[model samples]
Target: MSKLDIKQLTKQIIDGVGGEENIVSAAHCSTRLRIVLKDDSLIETDIVAEIDGVKGSFNNGGQFQIILGTGLVNQVYQEFLVQTDLSEVGKEELKEIASSKLNIAQRILKALADVFVPILPALVASGLLMGLNNLLTAEGLFVSGETVIGAYPQFADLAEMINIFANTAFVFLPILIGFYAAKIFGGTPVLGAVIGAIMIHPDLLNGYSYGQAVLDNTVPVWNVFGFEIAKVGYQGTVLPVIGAAFVLAKTEKVLRKFIPMMLDNIITPLLAVLFTASFTFIAIGPVMRVVGDWMTNGVMWLFFELGPIGGAIYGVVYPLLVITGMHHSLVTSEMQILANIETLGGSPTFAVVAASNVAQGAAALAVFYLFKKDVKMKAIASAAGISALLGITEPAVFGVNLKLKYPFVAALIGSAAGAAYATWREVLSVSQGPAGLPGVIVIRPQSMVQYMVALGIAFVVTFVVTILFAKMSQGKSKLN
Candidate 1:
């Protein structure tokens, strides 16, 4: 059977939906087609849902979503941009469309950037090296005697220094998040980082370590009320710093707007710093800690009750949380769990999630291979799959699987299989690892072989299943 010309099919699909006239805005994520319209009333979503290549269509967060699987979504997006009037929409209109009260994409995008942008460079460097390192270490190229070369006295010194700077962002994520949060809220990011630094100061951490309590001793410095507060280090934390930064940014903005210039310059910084720090120490930190504890305990209870199945279910839900931008809320909880409990056994859900990401990448690759006759589709699929494999799933999900019709199902099935296997095998991840190749190390060193095998099986299952399904349906003609 001849393959559907992806570009032509995309054009037809767009034209059927009233062309560029109907579209107000459009974007793609790892697995879905995100679109806003001038008037959804003018388009027939049910009709679009029944299109030859479209998997499904639904309205979410005020955007009309067309599920396109993984590999083909980018092709469709590109074709739409070329063949439709959406390309003609002015920048002001695009911004207005994006900022329309009903749209949440901007905020979601910002949050995603906040979490991912800072880590990207380090992630890329470390991820590629980590993969190569695994291969080298496995071949005994980096081994010294029975111990790894990293354990050698000469190598250990340099390795520790590199590891420190490379891993510091993750270790002190709260400070990074505080800076970004301040930027998001229209505040001085540098100031917010300084504030975050103070919260995580070594001296304060030492005080907390010594079991010191808040003492009611006021020491005024620069007209700001200073009281010795109980300290809880914010390094690698998520909630307290973010919460503090959010309040501080708003306070600073309001002060800048209303307070007289002379007083504003001096008084605003003092009040903002003092108030934000005080609130963080006295209220936000404790509350967030309690909340984090509760979440960890709740997940732990579920793990105890449902065992591996619960872990599998969590694996499935975690990605969906990432899609909705709600995953940030759980970062603090996961860190707290790591702090209180040495291992993530009680929360082994990410093992399956890691598999899911790999599965999605595989499914995308399958589509790329299947639609070889369509050069544009093939190119987009390859790029999307590679991106997914590297832990950047937006392009894969928004660009490929959702567009290909059957790949999303394949990804889900693959994830379920991986989750089930990991749960049954009691696979555990110790650290909060990347969702891609580096995550392979999350498995216990002794069980690394089993982890790789399980991951391979999941990817193969998803890829083969999706390719076969797509092949079987090739001869049949369907309408958009």
Candidate 2:
């Protein structure tokens, strides 16, 4: 869209939202302009939808979002700020406003999002490194049932080095989770890290070998007041550290309130560490560990036991989860899966995500051609389609597919089929990355070909279904 067009559309949107006075705060993601309105009833949804550049609009998390697609959103948002004379206070304030409107459950999920969002970079890089190492060491690259390490013995040390680099994140995952969770729960970040370190102390037996230790009858324990507490390291566990962080943060806060300022710094840290560690090792750690195991077993049942049927169900509901913003919780689940990548074989969830994402992209691509006569829609669909293929789907979803009912349904069908096939084939990613075609880099060496084939099936299915649906709806005219 042109500069003039953006400015004009911004004006119309402002008027539709009952002007600058009604808008409390504003933020923009890749595809939509998110605005917090002081008076919810003041905004005119029909008027906003009528605007030329708007692909779609909705109310989510107490924010009114107007979809304008990739590059165009930033332009319109800038123009919006200019027209309204609104300060660039940004997303933080919007988050606060949104939080106040959320229920207890939503707030809890938001906390999880906050704690995990910053950790993605480290995890993503590690995953990619691991993927590369897997490729380097995998068998059958040149000959059937022959290993790469055998072919190139000189690179073995380098591959082993890469493996160590990749394992660092998962090995010390609790420290990362604790520090962030502490920050989120309003505690000392360092204290959280300290508690995390305590959980994985060298003297303690590793959690990964807990089963083996039990089988061998070598599980170590500390007897305290007639109670036996196991000393198992939570190396790759998530929930235990999070619970420990919360306890640590709360303990520090309470201690500070009661203890005098003169002795506060020294006594507070001392008591906080000792108490948090004792409680964590004794109560919180064991309890959360059991809960975490339940979660692990649940996911294993869905993604492994049910296999293709599970994949289909997940694919079908994935889009719905995205719409509700509940998908953020899945990051924690993926972490658990990826943490035990050695044991789990592969991440079926990532494969399902890729299928779902690419299916949406394909649906958008079909729309781009279908609406070629309309310049604004064609631009929106084309940009959204490409963006979705790159692993970001909000643009394609809200901007094109979701707005057009048929394409969304088509994408769902494609996603289900692809996920089922991929799961059945046992396709899995080595790392967390984009779900688009470009995401192939993260696929494990053995599954790269299978992943590509699955995604190709998804693309074809979505495109064909969209075209057929659109043609069927041509006379009925209920697309939007």
Candidate 3:
């Protein structure tokens, strides 16, 4: 929209949402303008729906949201802020306001999302490279039942290098986590990296090999002034680094407050890192490690042990979690699953996610056909469908499915059926990636075909069911 048009729309939005007074805070994510309101009852959602540029709107997890779709939400959000005199509200302050209403669980999840979102590109790139490396190293797929490297001896060095490059992210995951987690928890990013490095330093016994070392009766420990503390490195752990960073950030902030300005510069950082490191190595790291292990084991048991039933249940609830915005929190769990890939066999959670994503996309695609005459809706559904198929589903869910109601239910049924098949066949991923068609790049070579079939089931089931539901809604009357 033009400058004047945006300004006009912004004014209309301000008026529609009970003016600036009703809004506690406002922010925007990929495609939605999210606002926390003092009174939800005062929200003029009908008026919001009538506003130009608003594709849809809803209230979820204390945030009243208006779906503006991609490429435009930011524009509207910026203008909304100017009109509401909230131009000075920065990201951190806005987050503080937005998080005030969230429960403990929600806040924790949101923190994970904040830390992981910035580093997602790194994870995605590494996952894709890992998948390529897997195909190159795996046997019985291409070239006379031997691995690609075996068939072509000339490429052996190249294959090894690819493997190294692919595994780098997972091996040094704590460092990345520490840096981002520190940023999230309000600590120095570089200091976080130093602490992260300390956890995986060569002087320490590798955490990955600690289990084996225990079996061999060779677990190493440091005599810390009479205390026997394990000198174990947290190679691929998530929670330990996160906890350590939180402590580091809080400790550094406290030191900065009490220390004199002259000596504070040198002493504060040094003491903060030293104290945080000592405490982490002594307590936080080990304790959090056990907690992390339990959480991983529980999820592993559900997907790998309970089989199809577990997968079906998770599939049904995945969309609900998305609605509540808690699904973003799963990034950390996905990391843990990938870290233990050798023991867990592979990552089934990713495969199930792929099924759920495909079903949502397929359902939205059906809506595009169902509302062919409504140009605005058709556009939203078309774009949302494609985006969901590419592993982003918020637009599809909020803009297309929930608006009509039946499409959401269709997606759930389809997702459940597809996820069951994935679990039954034990489909697995070699690395983490997108949750739809692109995710196939990361699936284990042996499970690739089966993974595709699972998504196909989701697409077909959701598409067919959405159509049937729309048609059955009324004999002579049209669906809203």
Candidate 4:
């Protein structure tokens, strides 16, 4: 590919998309130049596609997006800003403009993404560590004849020590979720952290073990204001913490408005915490627990009742969820599955998701081979495909597959095929990993082969289907 002249490319992009006046806002993700247009009709789609260095273009979630390779997109975005009226605007301002154009459901999904993306790194690390611990303990993997820690009783203590590190994060997951949730909701993060601590105080019953107590009718409750408040901690819970943080933030704002400014410093936080915490314990916490349980049972029912068919449906829709940014909302369900792995004998959800990611990458790889003549396009597709294989799919989906609509559909079909086979084989993942090819790290020893087969099917099926469809489209375009 020729070296990108940022100035020239940026000018072509701006002029082809109807100049600066036509743009409401502009931003770039890993490999796409995302813009919100004031009037969609003003965009010259053919002209934009023909611009030098532009790979493909599409409209999604009210944004007019243009695919450009990762490094080049940022340089083009910077140059585009300088040459246009957007130079003075911050990225956040552009995001706000784009968000203002979304519908109610889309706005909620965006909010969930904002809350979860910041905390994903920590969860990702803890999850990988859990998988590593499982691998080390798996029979015959890291041992001469048997499991490393299981056969040598002397090494048990050392194994337990390592387990502590793996368990700490998930054991206190609510605290982490609360801190991030509060920040997202415009509340004091420290205060939300304190609420998380309160919920998990040593005196309270551990939430993870609460189900047995519930079955035995031995669960503890605190009586306050003639109401019985469950004393179960919110360790692995997600919905309650998020709901609490949101309520706390709104309550604080209301208190600030009514409370005298002179006494604000002393009274506001104290009352905010007291009232919010009380209300949460009394109402919100219990209500959210019911909702969380419903979602958990719903997924459990789907998998157990319908088996492979359920997995097929989940796989087909998951990529579409990722596209709309709604996948973050399902993290709570994933966590619940992980927490109850013993009862479920392992969740097929993670394996299905991993297969979907592989399918997406495979579809992008097919597009990469199709555009072999265009060096810039091939390079972008290859890099995006590799990123997807490594467990990141935004670049592959938005930058390649979705730009050429057929590839995205091909990926979904491939994902469904893989997921059904995986579920039929009952492939199990012990914990979440970075996903995609690296997801092998989380598969149970006995299920590893099945997982690999699922992934291979997803990749091969998507690649062949996408290549055939793209070739057909090429012929149609020539005829036109």
Question: Candidate 4: what lDDT?
Answer: 0.80
Per-residue error (Å), model 4, residue 163 = 1.0
- Per-residue lDDT of candidate 3, residues 173-269 (tens digit): 8888889899888899989988999999999998889889989989888897799888899976888999999999999899999999999879988
- Note the Cα lDDT for every prediction shown: 0.63, 0.86, 0.85, 0.80
TM-score of 2: 0.92
Clashing pairs in 4: none
TM-score attained by model 3: 0.90
Off by over 4 Å in 3: 1-8, 24-31, 34-36, 59-63, 69-82, 88-97, 342-345, 372-375, 475-480
What is the lDDT, from 0 to 100, of the residue 232 in candidate 3?
92
Off by over 4 Å in 2: 1-8, 18-21, 29-32, 39-43, 55-61, 68-86, 215-217, 475-480
Superposition error at 412 for model 1 (Å): 2.9
| TM-score, per-candidate, Cα-based | 0.66, 0.92, 0.90, 0.88
Which has the higher lDDT value, candidate number 1 or candidate number 3? Answer: 3
Q: Candidate 1: misplaced stretches above 4 Å?
A: 1-22, 25-35, 38-116, 119-146, 149-152, 206-229, 261-264, 297-307, 319-350, 361-410, 423-434, 437-448, 463-480
lDDT of 1 by residue, 328-442 (tens): 5555455544433223432355567677788888888998888879776676678678767766665566557766658977887777777677766766554466766556665
Query: Candidate 1: deviation at residue 106, Å?
Result: 10
Top candidate by TM-score: 2
What TM-score would you give candidate 1 relative to the actual structure? Answer: 0.66
